[model samples]
Target: MFKDSKKKLSAPATDTLLANGTSFEGTIEAEANIRIDGHFQGDIRSTRTVVIGESAVVRSDIIARDVILAGKVFGSITTEGRLTITPTGELYGKVAVAALVISEGGVLDGTSQMIRTKDAEPSASTDDSDLETQSGTRKDRDTSQATLQSETG
Candidate 1:
């Protein structure tokens, strides 16, 4: 009753949320954008975007068009578009993404494999100013907490 199928096909997908102070464990498959700001343990398969808030703690594999991470994830993440990790984000598993952006303060403690996107040329380089190829020890960092401003921002 809340949505029409025709409109859903034409309109942009809405954002869905897993709020802070909450915990969940299961598989999630959706057409809309998904955001998490709490604890989760499962697999997430989405045709759209998936955003992990700075306060979130997740242990699941994620497959999405794009992912913006500002939290902690203990599983692999595969994306067709790009995976942007904010300063507070941390990932501990493998990632296969077409594009990746890790802010200065972000941390990734696993292997990252880059895939070629349709838009990228065969000779195009994946090395950008924000990307680095190196090996280092996983630093000991404390997980921070923050409150979500609104559900659908």
Candidate 2:
């Protein structure tokens, strides 16, 4: 029905997927989630989450609400929510995110910036605690914050 189609269009896309082993070259935009596990060369913009799989190879700038990377990227990434890098993740460009978590063996060959919204304020739901990291050699740091950042080699 036309109502069903309209509902689908308004709902957030939870699966905008690009499988591994495939190669693509163009711009990608999504309203919610986008997962990529292939070779890509272009720009990516998402209003929600962006996930890059382990075997993926990307060359583009990305702007999203959140990002999870386990592959390799050669461009800048901006996220307002969080950016998490698994052990196999490797990035070679700049990043701007609200929260960043890099596990041991993950690589970040560029700089990072932490940003917070203007209306951001301390609240009961926000935990500002120090996190113990088993990764980078840096000393333990207090991570209790609305903005969290940890760097790894």
Candidate 3:
């Protein structure tokens, strides 16, 4: 009998919270989402979402897939997906984001750059002889490489 072809989906990402009045100073790296409601003075790196609460005060850089800010931040921020600044938020550093949203009353006192999404691959030309298909189009070599690796193993 043939095995099931579909891959199983993973569970949703979890969230970690830093409660109010808590103060921390160090680097934070996590796979789950994070919500901060206190004072932080270090860097934050996450593969999931990061949220800064209304009463939070941060003085460090943040890198995440998605970011939501509703507090006062005094450092730079980079997001792979979207960055949202709520009405009560105030950001005072540079930002590099794929997409950004700032609500009314939100303040941004620094520069920002819109970055391209990582999902878009480079276009391939058919005039090259490296990977010309029967239809005169270049095949995606990266996809074929991945498939071959998976089949061999």
Worst 10 residues of 2 by lDDT: 5-14
Residue-level lDDT of model 1, residues 1-153, one tens digit each, is 676554211213448899999999999999989989999999999999999988999999999999988999999999998898888999999999999999889999999999887767555564554233221111212111112334334
Please list all clashing residue pairs in model 1, or write none if there are none. none
Report model 3's TM-score to 2 decimal places. 0.69
Best by lDDT: 3
What would the TM-scores of all predictions be?
A: 0.70, 0.69, 0.69
| Model 2 pairs in collision | 128-144, 128-145, 129-144, 130-143
Clashing pairs in 3: none
Arrange candidates, best TM-score first: 1, 3, 2
lDDT of 1 at 133: 27
Model 3 — which ten-residue stretch has the worst lDDT?
6-15
**TM accuracy, model 2:** 0.69
For model 2 the local lDDT of residue 64 reads 96
Question: lDDT per residue, candidate 3, 4-31, as tens digits?
Answer: 9964323234478888999999999999
Off by over 4 Å in 3: 1-14, 118-153
Q: After superposition, how far is residue 9 of candidate 2 from its true place, in Å?
A: 28
lDDT of 2 by residue, 49-140 (tens): 88888999999999999888899999999998888888899999999988998988999999999888655755556443422343322433
lDDT of 1: 0.85
Ten-residue segment with the worst summed lDDT in candidate 1? Answer: 136-145
